[model samples]
Target: MLKTRVIPCLLLRGESLIKTIKFDKYGYIGDPINTVRIFNELEVDELVFLDITATRENRPPNLDILREIADECFMPLAYGGGVKSVEDVRNILSIGLEKVVINSHAITNPNFITEIADTFGSQSIIASIDIKKNFWGKYEVLGVSGTKKTKLNYVEWAQELERLGAGELLITSMDREGTWKGYDVDLVRKITDSVSLPVIANGGAGNLQHIEEVVKQGNASAVALGSMVVYQGQDLGVLVNFPDRQKLSNIFG
Candidate 1:
């Protein structure tokens, strides 16, 4: 097994899989089931399937589709996007997902985090904090898939979530997402410095060096890939792939 977790964070828009740029524009990738098969063959550490539109649409998770993916997926899977109540988390876990990531609902009802963490366990929960910088260059927390910006200081929020029983944090950078530039190391460092939860730095991973930088410089425990895994390269065609594990082990070790 790999010492450092390298997860593929796939975006779901309706029944299809897609990749987004800065959480705004998107390109069709392919069907989620097919994509999961590809990742399975690669023996990836884990996979994150986030329904980018589920929460914004005011609906519960699409259990039908999730069940399909769960049936086909061989590796540990995590899900985010329309998870709201403890019941939803229960249902999702029953489908074999290792963790349920919460965002908008956690802001609306922090108690929900406590309730689920108590009912399930902290290890089963991953509090997702979507962050973006404003025009004035201040980091801001986001809800509803990076559309609704909040005034909550991200570092404080991350610490609170860890205190509230979140075992890990999915720190997403809206500005660098899908740009293939790199992760927001500064943003990740602040949260890591403030909280002990394992930080999975998401968004804007162009190469393995970016992964090395985030884990070393940013103190991130894991790295999440978006554009780097789904496409052949920046602006290239869709090809579900993962970096060679030998190269990754060499870098992280």
Candidate 2:
């Protein structure tokens, strides 16, 4: 079996790095380049940075900032937000990123998924799907940084993204984000089981055991963290942190 990846999912609002809870209540964290350097030293398996406001603000990812991040990062990096056409993916890759994640665009213009995969190889395409459960407990796929709801169900969307040529899926729980209560294990399991592509579970990861549950019970191939690794205390003090390789080995191996 391939080793499971434990990735840090960083959120960018304009040029600043921030963290959110339940997909709202954004809080400033730290500089992106500085944080990337720390993660590089920690030797993280990979890194995912999403510009949470890019699409909503109608601007492309800040290439100048991303270029600076590319220079400091030694591990594989994936970026998303404000990506519209194949050209955006091409440019993001040229900046040394290994993959481009498509969320809102994937839902609005799915053919772009095939075009990007065909040009860049499916391995370079990551389909990002954000989901939230309603009061009635029905999971719904959300777009535009979890601001808009879509009719499609998470499982159906997962299968469609795979069929559309997405090599990987970044599945996030909008409700659980930054809460660190635990990952929505059953939600992860349901989506992972419905598709053949590698699924990266995100949101609500508070402890090492939570990581274990998402992989063992959720059957996720990888896990992504935000608040659990970025905050130091209840006050949400900004810190550059990550699980060391030994801790990761305990769960992944």
Candidate 3:
């Protein structure tokens, strides 16, 4: 059986780390390097860093800060945001990230995905699909940090990503992100069932049970949590925590 990976999705704004809800209301979490050290100690399965403003600002990911995090990270790291060309993908991988994620460009310039995938092999590329429910009660694909909507269907997009040689699909539910309720299992299943590529479900992971739901029911290959892994207590103070060794073994063993 494939072991389900429990990943922490860290949001980046410039060099600082932040979290968001429903793709809005950004909240400062802490320093990226500091958080990475904590997760490294906890032995996290992997880490995903996304530059929330990269696309909007038309800037590439901060390689200087990312290099610092890469030096500290012991687990596999995947990065996303502002990757517009093959050179951008090459530079990110050269820094030691296991994968480079492409979002808005995947929709606006889909051929870019194929270009990168072909050059670096599919496993080095991840397709990030952000979804939000419109007023009409249907899930619509969003881009540019969830500010713009695309007419493409989420599942259809996932299929295209696989066809375009994306080794994995990272799906985030804008409505449930940072809500601490749970993942949108229906939304996860919508893509997992349509494609053979591994699907990493992000958003709405409140607890271990929520993680299990996505894997067992939604058939997701992995689960990525942001707020649940970063905050604690009644005040919801910034805290870097993860399931202990035995607890993690129980979940995936």
Candidate 4:
């Protein structure tokens, strides 16, 4: 079996890094560059930097900030937020980002996925799907930073993204986001089973056991954590934070 990845998901609001609950009530954490320096020392497997407010604010990614974070990062970095065009993808990759994740843009024009993949290869493209369970208990796509709802079914979207040449899928459950209640296993399973491409499960990661559950049950290729790693007063992110290489190997290995 391929080793699973434990990735740190950082939410960037303007120039600073922050954490949020249910995609709202964001609390400023620290500087993005400083966070990158610390994660480098932690020797994490990979990093995901998202400009959480970009799409909601109707703006493009801050390339200048991205460049600074890229320079500080030692591990592979994936960036998303307000990435709307092939040029945006090209510019980000040019500055050394390994992958570009598209949420609102992809939902609006999936062809951009094909265009980006054709130019940069599938491995450079990631489709980030934000989902929320409605009254029907079915997961539907949420857009504009989880404020608006799209009629797209989560499973159908994931399959389409892969068919359009997205190399990976970053799935986040809005209902479970930052709750630390654990991932939405059923939601993860739906996307993972529907796509041949790698799927990274995000939201609701509370502990190592939750990490194991997401991979084993959700069938995710990777598990992404935010508050669990950023909350300074918590045990997971504070006292027992920054998993050692051996511990990571034991979990992913």
Tell me the TM-score of each prediction against the true structure: 0.99, 0.97, 0.96, 0.94
Q: Please, what are the lDDT tens digits per residue for candidate 3 over residues 1-253? A: 1278788899999999998888888788989999999998887878999999999999888889989999999989999989898888888889888899889998999989899888999999889999999899899999999988889998889999999989999999999998888999999998999999999999988888788788888999988889888888223788888755566557665
Q: For candidate 1, lDDT tens digit of each residue in 140-190? A: 999999989788989889988998999899999999999999999999998
**Best candidate, lDDT:** 1
Residue-by-residue lDDT tens digits, candidate 4, 1-253: 2278888899899998888889998777888888888888777878999888899898988999999999989999999999998899989999999999888888889899999999999999878999998899877899888988999988888899999999999999999888889999888998888788999999998877788788888899988988877775443343214655566567765
Pairs that collide in candidate 1 are none
User: What tens digits encode model 2's per-residue C-alpha lDDT throughout 104-165?
Assistant: 99899989999998999999988999999999999999999999889997899899999999
Backbone clash count for every predicted candidate, in the order shown = 0, 0, 0, 0
What is each predicted model's overall lDDT from 0 to 1?
Answer: 0.93, 0.90, 0.88, 0.86
Any idea what lDDT model 4 has?
A: 0.86
Which ranges in model 2 have alpha carbons more than 4 Å from their true place?
Answer: 234-236
Summing lDDT over every window of 10 consecutive residues in candidate 2, give the lowest-scoring window: 228-237
Instruction: Write down the RMSD of candidate 1 (Cα, Å).
Output: 0.7
Worst 10 residues of 3 by lDDT: 243-252
Clashing pairs for model 3 are: none
Best candidate per TM-score, number? 1
Query: RMSD of each candidate?
Result: 0.7, 1.5, 1.6, 2.1
lDDT of 4 at 167: 93
